[model samples]
Target: MQIRDLPYPDPGVPDARSGPRFLLWLGRNQLGGQLRSLAWGLLHFGSIAGLPYMVGVAVEAVLDRSGGRLALAGALIVLLGIAIALGDTMLHRTAVTNWITAAARVQQLLARKTAALGSALTRRVAAGEVVAVSTGDVEKIGWFVEALSRFAAAALTVVLVCVGLLVYQPALGVIVALGIPVLALAVLPLLPRATRRADHQREKAGRATELASDTVAGLRVLRGIGGEELFLDRYRTASQEVRTAAVRSARMWAVISAIQVLMPGLLLIAVVWQGVHLAREGRVTVGELVTVYSAIMILNYPLRHFEEIAMAYSFSRPSAKRAARVLSLQRTAESTVSRSRDGSERGEAMAPVMAQPPADDSLPPTGDLYDPATGLLAPAGRLTAVVCGDPDEAGRLAERLGGHPAFDDAVDMPSVRLGDIPLDDLPLAIARTAVLVQDKDPVLLSGTLRELLDVPASGAVNPEEALDAAQCSDVLDALTQASAGDDPMTAHLTERGRSLSGGQRQRLALARSLVTDPEALVLDEPTSAVDSHTEARIADGIRHLREGRTTVVLTSSPLLLDRAERVVFLADGEVAAVGAHRELVHTEPRYRAVVTRETDAERVVDRDTDFLTELDIEETA
Candidate 1:
């Protein structure tokens, strides 16, 4: 297919058994493109190889003093030059097509895998590693894939040239044939060293990328702790180490390059020296001597291709392996069983959940959400606030509520059910629709506010209403003002909403979740970044808006807890107390202590604000 026709209709399923295997799979799928590239490559290199022979004939024609013979050689030379020009141009185009298509296919596969794995992909692989794989690694992989066909053509040209010499001049043929193997195979022993260094450099680079990402993400925290300079110094050290590793890796490759040139030059010297002796003895003619000498020089061109293919493979192998490992990740522990070989019954997991048809859009088992492990039940069509002391446990429980594995390797874990129907037994689409879990750090993808809020929502809550409930009027104003003439809905956000404050990003994310308007929504510390007043407003909005939906909140906020219809205080991973927030505050000391500490924290903030206000008022006077 042409470059415009890409990114392939289907990238095709990959073989993730090993890195080399993955590379093979990519090439095998693009056989048609590879063949086209190979044809062009052969035509180009064939012209280069044919040039020396034509020059030899021209020399012979001059020595013989024959005008017809000289004119014929000139005509052939012109034809070969034309072939060189056209072949080289087309070769470049086909090679580029292969490169872009390969990269596009890998990107699509990575995207598909990432979507399938969801948040678990990052839990298993570092965010930096993923970024590296999707960006830099993809380029390296494409480089090798595009090099394969050219290398094939170059190697073939070398073979045919050696054979032509054997037929035309047997003595020189022996020398060229013997030297060709040495030139090609001489770098084999050093390649292992080169590959190791490349791998080490890549590893160091990945770590450095991860460090930079972390430093940027927490730059504000570093400044708050008076450690920004310290972190900066650490990143500098990491950066220097990466540079050092890259330089070391480059030095090795340079040595290999030197070998490629030096060995070929030495072979040319030997061939020319021998050719002169043969001419002196009258055993070979002057035209043959020139042919042998110029042929060695032409051989140098293909030799560079050999080194390039080696270098490309050395780099792309590791990249392909990293890509393979990510693609191998499964969304669920038992996904292999749920999906059929032909994908005929890909949604087989939902068979148990959808045993009978339903009249409404909602799936069957439309009742309370019950986590078997913690004995936590969120009653249907009500707001339930869960107070957990440990944030990690709260996060794990929230993930479990949506039928997702809390830990990276969690398997055969207790299942959460929608009443009698197991949530994990349903297809991802149904499960996601049934229970929408919004973690505290919800990402604001780069797009206009309208696009960000445009999701597969239930159509119950409009973006305006959700934004109002999320208390994002200031956010809209900020976006609109920053975007100049653009409306808030059309105002584009930068990646991760970097332009917005933490409170604004959180409010916008909350607005997006509210827009989805799922039957059951689980929010983890949704109001943590917002002020107490805004949090109170959000609490009121949620209560008024979600009048008949299942809303589960995992937070220790007193205001949110007070507004909840029923509060479940979890201790030691199980429900320790369940009642109205007022009843729990009055009766349960464990529950009351948690809420009291949060309330005290809010009061401290109030006192600090008041002190600042008083100092400002005095300064104004």
Candidate 2:
């Protein structure tokens, strides 16, 4: 395929059987490109193969003093030069195209897999590994694939040259032919060691990359906790390890390269020595001796390709294996029968304790969200609050509600289903239409505010409405104050919205989510960064805006909890209690401890306030 035709709409599923098998599969899929590359490769290598013969003929013509034969040889030389130039240029173009298309195809497949697996991808594979596979690994895989045709051409050229030499002069040809196989196979014994070193280097490098990626992603938090230097030192150690491994790997390859040069040089010398002996015995002419020498010298060029092919395969095999591991991760139950729909009692856990139609002018959101794992059910057209003591579990739950199920090895774990449909089996379009999960730390991608808020082609929620519902007036005010004469919607944000305060970023993300107007929305600690007063306003605003939608807010805040119609208190990842905010606080001690978290000083203040209220009542009586 051409470069312009890149990024195939459907980069079909890759064969993840094994590293070598996967590489073979990639070659089979790009047969047309490989053939084109092969054709060009043949033209290029064939021209080089023909060069020695032309020179040998020219030497004979000159020796015979035949001016006409010499002129014909000169014309043939010119023609060979032209053919070499065209072949070289076209061969480069085709080889590069094959490399690019192969890399693009792998990238597309990885991207598609990433989108399909969503948050579960990183859980199954390290983020750094994913990054490595898509970037460096893809190039290596493509490199090996592109080199295949060149190696084929080089092998063919070597064979043809050997046959021609044998026909012209069997005595010298025998030495040349024997030496070729020895030169090619001489490095086979050293390859295993070199390949092992290369594998170690790649492993160290992958770890270093993963460490760097994690450190960078958590830089903001690291600085807050005064652990930046600690992480920097850790990364430095990792990087040094990678460097040492790479050096060792390079040294092995360097030895192999030296051997490649040494073996070929010795063979060339032997061919010349034997040719001279044949000439002395009157068995070979001066022209034949020169031809034998030139042909052996030409053979060295194709011989180098043998080493390159080996190196390429060694590096790419591990890369293909990594890509296969990532592609092989199945999203627990999303691919097959859903854990929730497997006729287990776990499904009952997701049954809604109460179902109520929304009271609003807006249309009610579609679908019921059920977390079979925790038995947390969010009925249609109502606001539900999930109070979890553990923020990490809360975050994971939010992810599951958005059709990205948690991938775990436990057989007892229930599947996270949406609207009675298996999350993994459902198409992305339908999943997106069903729910939108807003994380506690949502990413604010670099773009204009307008672009950030734009969600697909939906017109259900306008920018003004969403911003106001998310209580983003303060965010806009801050942006306006930061840059005068700029529209809030048109203002640009830095990566991850670093330019905005944590509260501002959270509100903006909430606004973006609101614009999607999905059938179900899961907000995890959405207002944790804001003040109590702003949190109260936001809670009221969220209730009003999502009046007729399925909304589940994971928060311990009293204000938000009071606003939700039903509050499900989670203790140790299971439903401990379910009731209204006031009732749960009074009846459930664990729920009260989790939600209130009041200290002794706060309790004294509450007692004093109550005493003053009683005194005021007595004075009124």
Candidate 3:
């Protein structure tokens, strides 16, 4: 694949069985690119191989006093120079292209996986590991993949040089041939120790990176809790451990490098000493002696590749393993709509099923959402609220409604269905079209306000209407204040809406979700960040906007719950009571305790005021 064709039309499924297998798969898929790189590598190394042969011919011509031969040598030198220049340039170009194409392919695979898995990606793998694999690890994998062709060319050059030496002089050839293998194998013993150190260093480094990422993401919270120094200290310790491991790894490689140099230098000495002896005995010409020595020196060039290829393989092996692990993760069947209601495959049945789109003929099952785990049913056309003592349980229920897997239960747990289709058997389109679930902590994608609200959806709802229904006037005001543009919708937001307060981000997320206008919308604490006044307005707006649509809001806020047509009170993860907000509050004390967490001081003031009023009446009588 060309570098420009990057993000290959189809990255194709990776062979994620193991690290070596994955790398092999990458090489096999990009055979054309690797071959191009190999062709250029041959030209470049071939030019170097020809240089020594020409030098020896030149030496003989000068000794014989043949002007014609000397002139011929001069012409050959010029041609070789041109070859060297052209070969070097093209070789570099192809090598870089190979690197970029390979890296691009891995990046595409990672991006696709991340998009398919969504939030589960982070939960399955550490966020830092994901970042590292997509960035640094991808480059390392590409580096090794690109280096393979060069290493192959170098190995071929070494074999050719040895053959030439044997043809020129038998005694010197035998010594040179025997010495080259020693040079190659001398460093093999050190590799295992070196690879072990590298692995240790990489593990420590990954931990350090994970800690730093966590620290930065939660920096605001750290400062609020006065624990910034604590985390800083932890990060420092982690960084030091990474440093120590790196130093140890570096020392091992240093020893290997010393051996690489020492072994080749010894071979150079052997070829020189042996060539001189053969010359003195009249068994080899002086020109032949020069040639053998030059060939041995040139052997150093290809021999160094032994170390380079080894190091590349060592580093990339672990990187490929990490990347493979990520690529292999498939969304649990419970977390997404099944391919078919009857357990038949809908698409190509790819390993990571989410990467494939559902069949075009598929349609969503018709009915309200029912989560058997909690027995919470959001009827077809009404605003329903769920109040739970535990916020986490409420959040899980919201996720299940939107097709996310339950954290505590087995994926095969039996589930209720709508229209003969089990919740697990519903097509993906059902999750995308039939319901839209907004998490308690919704993310506002980075873009202008209009783009944020214009995400692809099946329904066509006006952006202004949704924003208004979510009570997002303050959000627009904040964006207008932050931007130079006059239109608030044109104002750009920072990543995840970092430019806005928590309440503004929540409102914007709510507005974006509302604009989808799904058949059913599940919102978990949609107005939790806003004050009671703004929340009351939002509750009224939502009720009016979703007048005849299925809306489920999971929250305990009285202002929100009071507006719901019906409320479902959850206790210990089951539906304990179901009624209107006021009726449940009076009938279920457990529900009242959860929804009403008013401060004791506020209640004490109410009682004291009642006692003073009674005393005033008594004094007046």
Candidate 4:
């Protein structure tokens, strides 16, 4: 079957029994290819078994002093050698096909699961665990699945050889049959302990990989805070732990390997010793003794497979368990549609109109946005500014307004009910269309200047107008300078917009969000990266551009606040007082203290200085 045709199993509820069962299922599903591979394996192993029998015939012919029969025996040996070489080539070709196909299937499943989980995956499973499952675990699973058929064929070949020995020379045959199992099964008891060690090693390796990934992602911040060396030391310590775990895992396998070699050697010696005794008693001819020895020597191939199968199991079981854990994470509950206000078509129309006022109850209250959580309502459809004394309270209020699930518990207790409307129930495509959040450090993907400004879903505004509204004309000029006008608007950006300065990247991200022009826009410190002059221009432009739109800006910048129609002072994360910028400056002492950074005496002095400076500048002009 094609990879695309394989059914995608639900990752959130992976069947615990399915990992091992999948091998049987795959064999059944791809029975034709499996049968072809098995046929080749049998043919290859059969040819090998026939060689020892042919050698015995050649030795017997030499002992009989029969020249014609001796010549025929030599010809038979030559033909058998050619057959073994041909079979071995075909065997390898088919086995590799089986291995590749199995690995491909596992990879396809992993890709589907990643797509299904989306953003929720990172919140639930460790990034390193997912990486390990996709890379190392998939290959190990394929190795075990492919080994099953080869193991079956090897086992059959050994049985055939033992049966032939029993018929040709009974006493020596019994010893051969009994000794093979003892060597093969001896490694079985050590397998459980070996597997446990391997599992522990894999877990430690995954944790180290996660730490490395996190460190790289945050390296810039770590360095800025002078903690880079400290983090590096911690990572080095984690690396050493992984190394120690790996050594412990390797030691266990080493013991298994020693046993695999030593047991086979001892078995070989026992068979040789018994064959010598039987020959002296005249119970077996010299040629028969040679055949028994040859079969015993050939038993190594099957015995070696026993060790390999044990190893495959030890690796695959824990890997499957890890994969299962990732698939078991639950998705959030979907939203439910409420009944219309009336039973008429007008009611149907009115229901949507009313719902628009609160399209997503799951969304937390922004600065002026009403949240039913704390019984505080920032009146809808008006510009509202929040002034919070505690930065932590402001951040928490912002998170609640954003409808983060972690803040759901704080809903509907004089605060807004963000969970009344099921977030999952709202069509993601529709919910995102209404509410757009512009974070402080919005991620910028590598692309041309024009492409970077294109919003994810809708493209309503003209690109140039959006850029102008965001006061990013200078940013556009910089792009042209860098690109030399060959393709200024289409110049490629580096990953994460690394080629652009921090403020430039921030402006571009803002322009991209503005282009979307959602019904409600919540911006958290959008102008924090820009200079004071640019910040003032952006604040004035935003007020003009978003005249009729519901826009919420979270910032401590007085420049941005001066443009707001209403400002709400938040003390300890709740509404302490609310008014226009000038009104709050007079009424709320804490608000005046925060925004003006002054005591009453300093405020009067600063006010006089501001009045005199304005009058002097006017006279000079």
Winner by TM-score? 2
Global lDDT scores for all candidate models? 0.86, 0.82, 0.80, 0.69
Taking all chains together, each candidate's TM-score versus the true structure is 0.88, 0.91, 0.88, 0.73
Candidate 3 clashes between residue pairs 3 or more apart in a chain or in different chains: none
- In the range 305-357, model 1's lDDT, one tens digit per residue, is 99999999999999999999998876666532211112111222221232333
Q: Against the true structure, candidate 4 has what lDDT?
A: 0.69
Ten-residue region with minimum lDDT total, candidate 4: 345-354
Clashing pairs in 1: none
Candidate 2 regions exceeding 4 Å error are: 334-365, 409-412, 598-621
Q: Across residues 1-621, which tens digit of lDDT does each residue of candidate 2 receive?
A: 799988787778789989988899899998988888778777878888777777878898988998888888788888888888988898788888889989998988888788777777888789999999999999999999989988888888888878888888899888887888898899999999989998998899899999999999989899999999999999999999999999998999999999999998898888888878889999998888888888877777888889999999999999999998887776555233334332322234446443243343143324577777777777778999999877788877887777666676324555556555545455576666667788788999998788898776257888899899888997887777666746877777889999999998999999998888888889999999999988998899889988888899999999999999988888777677788999988787777878899666776787799799999999999
Error of 4 at 80 (Å): 6.2
* Model 2 score (lDDT): 0.82
For this target, which candidate reaches the highest lDDT against the unseen true structure? 1
Model 1 misplaced regions, further than 4 Å: 335-365, 419-427, 476-495, 598-621
Q: What is the Å distance of residue 321 in model 2 from its true position? A: 1.5
List the RMSD of every prediction in angstroms: 9.0, 5.0, 7.0, 8.2
lDDT of 4 at 485: 82
Tens digits of per-residue lDDT, candidate 3, 251-324, equal 99889889888987888888788778878889888788888888878778877888888998888998999999
